[model samples]
Target: MGGKVVFKEYDPDQLTFLPYKLEELVPQGHPVRIVSKVVDQVDVKPINRKYKGGGASSFHPRLMLKLLIYGYLTNTYSSRKLEEQAQQNVHFMWLLGMKKPDHNTINRFRSEKLSGVLKQFFSQIVQLLVAEGIVSLKEAVFTDGTKIESAANRYTFVWGKSIKHNKEKIKSQLDELWKYAQTLAGEERLDTSPTTFTEVNAERVKQTIASINAALAEQEDVDPKVKQKLKYAQKHWTENLKKYDQQEKLLGERNSYSKTDPDATFMRMKEDHMLNGQLKPAYNLQISTQEQFILNYSLHQTSTDYQTLPSHIDGYEALYDTLPKAVVADAGYGSDENYCILEQKGIEAYIKYNIFDKEQKEGIKDFSNDSLHYNQQENYLTCPMGQRMQHIGDGQRITTSGYVQIVSRYQAANCHNCPMRGVCHRSAGNRVVEINHSLRKHKQAAKERLNTDQGIKYRKRRPADVEPVFAQLKHNHGFRRFLLKGMSKTEVEIGLLSIAHNLRKWKA
Candidate 1:
């Protein structure tokens, strides 16, 4: 009772000595301060140019940008939450200089004003770090990729395969109608071209349907099935073909795209909530780091990492006006196209191939063509049974991306009574093996570089340098899903995340 009676007097209305400046109140090494300092040095003229001289005044781009970046920095991703924080949080208030921007103003600024300019703004921040000795582009880049869920509906997928299937179905139906028309009106009146339905457009389909209906109109005993089928195709064939044309245009180079957000591709995400490998609408976020700071970032619709390196390097060149001297990436980026491109560009690819780990394992014997004993001078491979495989022909195949792969085919003379015939060569006749000598040469060169002392150092440094940044932003900062829709706006969201990540690293 005596201790309870000694409580200090309290008054809600009483005012005490308060700091006049927010800088004096906030700590020296706060993350908010780091974001503010980094963004303040960026030239917002690119963003400022986004707005023509308007009649109504808007918040300064610098103030809007600072709030947007600091919001992402502190895990406040929603524009509504940012507006609330700008009103209530002292750091946000100080960063905004006491100017309050509502959620609409903030979202508009982020989604529209910073649409194409955020990358430049991000590059400027990286340049400032270069100026202040915080990070470097001269260092070898550690590259990686991860899928981030798009702000698109999951069930609203438009499948390219389905589109092709339906289009072919239309062609088949049209061809069937032509045969029915020829049955009734003879071949003279219904002389349709053989290739009429092979290549079709909306207008061509409409004309063909009209011709089919006209040819059928000449008959008195046309079957009800033919008339009914012609009736439906007349109603929907042209319309369906038009929609398929639009869907194909939206697909670009992807197999599937979301109807809500046409630019987002449906990809198998590791962060699947169903845990059964469900494919979701997501973007491939490619980021490269040096000293654990994100140096460049790009978003791609492609799901695989192999198809993304060339364009990712293009983005890096766009940002810093130079390519990275060396790039270390996982085996996913290893492909014939990627290897040839890196060798062409003279960027020392510390990139591991798809078989990089398996080939290094000892004790197990591999019987693949790549493991064969090759006479380099004679361009022939010796079989395990001491039989010679002659170089027969050079076969060429092209990938979907137009990369031509030349494979040298070799055939063994005979395999009669050889003990290793079934084990080493699985063919009853003479065994034929096709080899892409260029790819093999690339793998050998990469293996040599990866086993070197410097390569060993980067091999150890890669996982530590890049994975932590992704984990920090995704797990700790809660940025796994994008807050905006469409490619341009979604890219701006990733750019902000990368900037926030680098600034937090600098603060640390």
Candidate 2:
């Protein structure tokens, strides 16, 4: 059978639009009302224009503010785009009260009010969530750190101004380019024929070299105080110039250099590069969530995961009244300082250290004699060579419900003649190797978490809780790179994106 014909027009009146209200679609007692309420409380008296004669009119600050915020929540960050959508999209139309706002007006509203407005909105949301009982301060919460990729590339990276010495790399590149330019310039009877390229291109190469060298020379002459800035400028200039030169040189000979975005950086996704491995520049987004709702998110330029924990915790606590009850994190968040901080906070934290090797240094495990085991409080340890270590003077000791640490030193004389010297002693001869009293806290926690039913539930729930949110933003929402520069702006961008994600989730 043949296909049936179908036709459609862009007429609005002929369509029967469904009643899909944004306000009605959202959950009961959503923070949108709180947003409206808080915005109502902001004073617009100062913004009102006053004539010399008498009273004056005031622009609707609240309406414009609401539109801008709703725009952010919907991921319509571009002011022009927001304005276009406001006239077209039903939700945006309703939010903006069917008024056609110019793109410039929208931009001014966002740029002028975003800083203060976002903070106010965030505080109100926190307060509303607290009131709604979505957050519980009494339960244990798990925490993890993830690196946020920055909008800027590392090549744009500027460092502290230092002019101690010259680098041979720059010298080498300059020398090579100069030689190549000289060679290109000297070419006579340049081949018009593609097959017979006249005497290797020297003059072109020479010009290129001269250009690069000039940039280098300028950098070298810059004042020591301003050398860093000069270096950065030269680096960027030379790189861009080289790209142009290479493209022009290869013209039809090769494909044009395809770096359309200079802000992008190559991010390594895996430790080892396999055949099918992928690499791309992406923002490392860090998010903190509660009750399946994202509380905070931040973007950073960190390549490592170690440094994001403390600051994130601080940010969360500052934004919200209380911290999550029990902080659960992966091994990346595990550090001596973090452990100390968690303990100090009186929070039950479960951060796993990535230490898998559990081999005993010596036969110290066998040294737990009847006497040693009986008096567990004393500061003593067993040596690998079946010898007991006793503390000489006042030494520090730590104890937990699971295990006690008895740190002590072995006699150098006794360790010297031990038959199992290689395993027990790492030094040249009889030397005491101070051993930490082994505590089974980590082992016990791991075992219980993997075995117990509650632990199993938490483990299962964790990945589903946070991982999908990130996947949605990155995959569905086209939020891979940032639109702003610098850490503070990046943080704000992240916050907006997070707000957008939550709003979408709520809408869905």
Candidate 3:
């Protein structure tokens, strides 16, 4: 051993002057400080109005809001995690003022107290950005949507097709049972009137099964197969019908719904790792953004993006009491209803049709419906064969939202023995085309608006403005799946996320 060896001191338990200042513990430019500062300026009267007087002296809504917004900002969505952070993390400790509310309090505050008024709080934060000139409602509001997985079990789902098929199976079996009962004594049928199986229900099915059971009760020569079928129907069919009724009620306008979370619809997710065309229960998250800041956001049960745009714009108008001066969206949101609504609101629609880009390519529009020359005065289209196609029929199409579009059907005179017939028409008969005049006119106007210099500028900015925010939320912040269950609670979660994002950007 060497002589004169020296060692520094190490203490497991040592206490000097016990002075800890959380204010100085956190830095001046920390994001948590920004979250606390921004939320302090916004009013929470809407959330305060939700509480009734005198129930064990609750935590202040502003405090709860700060904890939640900051929690979301840091990619901590679980209430229990937020609670732990409040007790352990210095940033959270500084923001919460050393008050550690349990997970129950945090969750109840998020799910119950912040249900409806959370949107108002988000709007207030956005209004602050507007006041500071970081964003403007008059600028183009770029709308886009992405499907996020719901907080539900993926396997528990009910399909409208399956329900209808089960009912049809019941109907077919009932028809067979009735025909079998008719061969028995005719007087036994009068004991209970024959319930109509045309339009089936739980009560009707039960009545019909009862009558069949009574009719076969006294027939000693009846086939045991008939009795077995009737027994199965009595044991399972009526109850299945009742459950189907409940499921149908839950799936009002949706094609499929998750039983775990009834508000979530089955949609084809792009994040399918296996790439086998898997559908997951998810919600369509629609948001309008300006300068990468979310202006308005809405959650829809509908899977398609086109159907969600009008409602999204409506939600934006509800929040701001006015509409954006212009909207720029991708082709998914290009629909006749959307175009009409945007025109009704007097906003410039730089929306692209599904074939807007494809049709502009060389030789792509040849022999297509749009390429058919139409004389506006005569209302007849000249086909590729130079034959005049007259209108054959006109019908009305009522959209799910009750918007009516009148479709006119036109047919070519003949396609027999034409050189271009093989390429022009695929059907056996003449080429028939259906067109909506109003929809075409709207598309033409949209085309004109989308080709201008202003439209090109917005086109480039749309992806930059809206997509990075989603990328940051999903990739960086890890907000890919929701924490809450129902639409109302999940809506509040998104509102919290929006506020956190705005504040985080504002501080930056």
Candidate 4:
């Protein structure tokens, strides 16, 4: 009581002044704050102008972009839902600076400027992250391709088999009918007068007309399972069926059609049933993951992973100055051309080439590690017959292993008389077989990777690091199907997905 004594009357409705510092309601350490801080470094000035000059005083481009990205992370891609969230949700409100951007604006921004603005935005974010030391280019990267179905229905497929079979049957029937008519006309001597062949001619001509009409109209019965078969057949028959009575003039033309989306293709990945369900014309989404960040993405019509390697490498190199130290991919991307591209680019790639037992099957004892035939750089195998089979062929007499495959071009006279022809030479002449020796460059690279613990460990990291990326995209991000059409549009959409993926990684 000696120091201080205070007496206060507290009223529930009375106004009172309190001393306190006004600070941000949102925490600085939140994931949203981290994302915002990272995105703040992105220069949105130029891109924002594309949606400028509007009288409605539209929402800030940077804020809208951030919110859209947030939507992607939360799996809320619907523009209407985003609009509602902006108005009601506190987190979205803060991220968007409390501007309630209409659904139309959000839709237009993504659809229109997505190709250029969003792509550059993503690149800039990646560059910023790289500069911040979050991603190490030297560590490892996994490149993979996944199928994103289109917005169209799967009922619109054009099967080559159905189309081919129908065309062949029509042609066969038309040929038989024409031959019979020609034989009857010649036997009746109808060339001279209508009366001479009139008795037989009237009935035959009517029969021929009916037969031709039936054949022409038979397209209606074309395979319903084949999307464009009916349409193609109808078009051909309507145009090419000269006069119904003129059976000789009937000419068969083969064509195909697509019902749902004309551009869609029937993709085959091993057996028929693997991708069996209904499918639309889809784009292969190619992503480059660096340190768990999807740096760049591109969409291609390539049905296989083989074709995506060159383009993905080229695109990644173009965006980020150099190629990744190691590009890991599934067996689908393993090909001679891919290896050649990686080699040319000075990129060390770890793509598995065992698609069809070309490489040893998984869990098949991994005999490759134990076998002396395992040449890292040359990708060769020592056959049971003591012949060295070219694992990676250079497509010429010279093998990739720096060994020249010497072929004994002994004349037919020499090989035909060989006593061991059945065992060594199965041909009529002396056969040439392959021989392999290690190349200096290949040996060095292989030794550096396979022989060392770091290289082997990183090589094993390929599956763990990259497979989850595709899994996340497919299961969480709704990237199983594409939202846009054409390669360019699909590219834009895929790029956004990659951007969204990288942004999420950075936030995490």
Best by TM-score: 1
Kindly report which residue stretches of model 4 are placed more than 4 angstroms away from their true locations once superposed. Answer: 1-25, 45-57, 160-281, 355-454, 476-479
Model 3 earns a TM-score of: 0.95
Q: Tell me the lDDT of model 4 at 492.
A: 59
How far is 262's C-alpha from truth in model 2 (Å)?
Answer: 15
lDDT of 4 by residue, 252-346 (tens): 22122234534444343221244665444566677777666786687665467777677777877777677687776766775556666678787
Candidate 1 versus the native: TM-score?
0.96
Q: What TM-score does structure 2 among the candidates reach?
A: 0.57
Total residue pair clashes for candidate 2: 22
**259, model 3: CA deviation in Å?**
1.4
Cα deviation in Å at residue 196, candidate 1? Answer: 6.0
What TM-score does structure 4 among the candidates reach?
0.64
Error of 1 at 198 (Å): 1.7
Where does model 1 exceed 4 Å of error? 1-5, 16-23, 363-366
Q: How accurate is candidate 4 locally (lDDT)?
A: 0.58
In candidate 3, how many Å is residue 305 off?
0.2
Q: What C-alpha lDDT values do all the predictions have?
A: 0.87, 0.51, 0.88, 0.58
